[model samples]
Target: MTGAVLAERTEMVDGAPSALAALRRGEPVVLTHARERHLVIAAERVTGRTMALLVRYSSGFACVAIEGERLAALDIPLMEADDAGREAFAVSVDAGAGLTTGISALERARTVRALAHPSTTPADLVRPGHVVPVQVRPGGVLERPAPPEAAADLCRLAGLVPAAVFAAIPESVSEPLPTALADLTTVRVEDVVRHRERAEPLVHPAAVAPLATRRGLLTQHTYVDVRGGTEHLAVVAGAVADADAVPVRVHDECLAGDLLGSVRCRCAGDLAAALDAVATAGNGVVVYVRGGAACGGQPTGVAVPADRDRVAAHVLRDLGVRSVVLLTDDHGHAGRLSAFGMPVVACAPLTPAGQCDLRAGAVE
Candidate 1:
């Protein structure tokens, strides 16, 4: 059935305030227009369970909306808890004129799916002042149409302000959601944006334990950003090779490749190469950044430039190293460390064996 049939009963719609409260309490709300239906929910309220329900109810993944100003106030812990949540959290926007409004039907459909499965954050659908990322699975681009109008209508009918819209499968044929998310509803994206909280601080690092990998014995160090209330890790291969030019890599965390051995990205290989390079050199530091959870689950790669420079530098300094020979693929890090007077080396790609494809003793 199409959303038109499901949303035909316009009289049953609830007030905006109650709908907004339902969203805060983790409910899925169905909003309809002439022929469109939207399953709207707040980004802050998204959980793995709710995500499952949203996807199941809509017969596809859910989309997310966030106000511009509340971007920084996003719940990092919540974003990192689920893979799709991370993808949704990564979409960015400026505000106002920059907001995305107009789009071809095909383009909107593709954008919604892209937002769900991003390598980095997708940038095509620019919605000024708000960041809306949808939880769509890839490869069914045309399966669901974008609900731009329905999102706006729902927000307007519910008396809620708009931020970004996450397009989901129409619930025309779906049954009422279970009790957990029966009230999946929303409030003014504006109110949530206005009442958003600041990120917690990252205080200091604490030593974990010595972990022995195939390469060698390594000491693990964990630092909690108490203010940000997140944790970061540093894997030390061996004694410092040189204080002036210590080999170091600021690696971003990847759930798929690093842990699950997925080949979608080279993160796993990159990480192994970094560790091996450091091990071969018999010294150096590999700072594995929990960039996602630590910084509110933004997209890895370009979206988050691994702003762990200060943390990496701190680790080196604490190890009695004054400077570093930075190892990385991202030019952003290369530039940041170079400005700080550290020698930088843009990392070469790794061979299939997870070894650096470089001439003997070359990182430049």
Candidate 2:
């Protein structure tokens, strides 16, 4: 094994001469410290080609492991002399030595200590007279003036001096103000009031509607009564009605895995199979139930175990969707609809391949 040890300011660069020479010869290196060790495995060990350097940090310091061919391209310096080089060496040593703690933890501790002894409120990152955009209910971003009043309010919220607040304001508003007013303590009540007045008219409302009727989708606004409010709900149908049989799929909204096709979850595959099944029939409706339940008193956006399944049954029954096929990865969904009078089919362990075949009647 060949490695360097680093802690605090001092670092040791020496190692076994044979091992060090082996490393220079492009052989693998094993780093050890504090009873922990890590292997810098050569890519040739895994694959026939000499491509990458794979550093497998110990489990305690697993967070810092870097893989792939990028590491092999770096120029490995024989020694460290300057502060930057020393710091780089320290990082590698600490990472290889399995130092479980991160430098961020020390910085956070220092910040906490400083905040504990604070004599003044924190500085505001944003200032008044700046035109910050507000996202109104429906759709677009509304850029409005950060009047003195709003600035003062923001400063107060951020625990910053009002003058500091003014200075931080967008250049357009701050440039027009007198130099004296730019001082953190010199902001006037009238200035804030005037700024607020100029800002009041910029807020707007918006909503979202479906682009058009199509397979497995519907759309509507969430809140209709509030003025200047804009929030739209995109409803996807779970199952569509058919003359011979109704095909349905219960889908949960997975922002990352479904929309992004992240392999971490099966949401995207299941949704695609369901949509494909309904679309092929050319008559079924996919009643896209919102992931969470509509029940009052429940935490917002929490999907109750069987809420969507029940909703699906209700919608299907109302629409005269007989011979319905229920699709879902959640076993709880099947339990919820079991008591209903209609026949329902569930696709558990709902893999995309499995769902595709099931929906196509290739599997029972």
Candidate 3:
């Protein structure tokens, strides 16, 4: 695309916040990638009414996008054993109870909810069922930044489970992003990147120290942000700016879990795992934000506020890190890193223990 065309397209998108607001309010949104568009709905919010809309206008096979680790937690495996396929399709499933058949719109909606629920387990789902769950390819939108990844990213931004129900619209890529699809908000992937890139993250470097720890000699960065007025830390292991697909972990503060070693959440374990990965990687970073807001008041540290995520992104950029492969502790969090031009090439689970139950802080 020409520069003028790119600029015009950028103007058409309002980006994450707008889409996030609508999703939080239980509304669907149009997510665009390249020229193709898809109708996306939060998995938890999918209803009979919305299912009908997707079925009529979208690709008939509506799929729910989720983190691959969550799939393992529920005893679901990728459709392909080797997981070499690009589609990222996993074993299909349906709600295990309260439904006679899985083909109905309402039934499929229930299946989606089961997938998104934190308390849901393998027994709560039946394999080879009506609803298909597609794993979000790590680094989330930062990795691919396509419709599927964007759907999951938007859901996460709304402080919901990263699972999303999305289906391709019949619309052609040459068409303009719709301002109204039954009044659903529209967000273009590139537009979100531009929106984030419009300004630098609001943070000022305060201090740096060479910290000697068990992992090795790691550098620590402290930043004071005027907006949040919080002291955020970025611990570095060796040189990263010159690397590609460098490992990065954006850890939001969770005192109760990280400090107290509370079994109530996996915050502590995830943090330790991240530290281990960075130390071993020899070229990585762990960005820590203070006072993280849990998703829906849940104790999980998975959801980092969009602004804080942006701060982490800028910190990485300042460190000279180019593209990255996210070293995620739990859930599917890529944040708005890709938005600021710091691409997340992939997401790797540091250890199998961290991969066990994706929702460590979830309650029934």
Model 2 per-residue lDDT tens digits across residues 91-193 = 1211112223413333222221222222313231111111111111111111121222232232222333211101122223323444422221222222232
Question: Model 3 misses residue 159 by how many Å?
Answer: 0.9
Q: Residue 271 deviation, candidate 2, in Å?
A: 1.2
The model with the greater TM-score, 2 or 3, is 3
lDDT leader: 3
Candidate 1 structure quality by residue, lDDT tens digits, 1-364? 2223222322233345566556445455665433545566444344445455555656453344432223333311223333432343444332222224523222333333333222324233354323344333221111122343234333333444443244454646545645554545533322221122111123376766898989878888887755475677888777663555567877767665578865445566778888888888877788776654211122233433424554454445455555555665445565544433233433333344442222222221
- State how far residue 351 of model 3 sits from its true place (Å): 48
lDDT score for candidate 2 against the true structure: 0.32
Best by TM-score: 3
Q: Model 2 reaches what TM-score against the true structure? A: 0.29
The lDDT per prediction is 0.47, 0.32, 0.74
Candidate 1 has a TM-score of 0.37
Whole-model lDDT for model 3 versus the true structure?
Answer: 0.74
Error of 1 at 226 (Å): 3.6
Q: Which 10 consecutive residues of model 3 have the lowest summed lDDT? A: 1-10
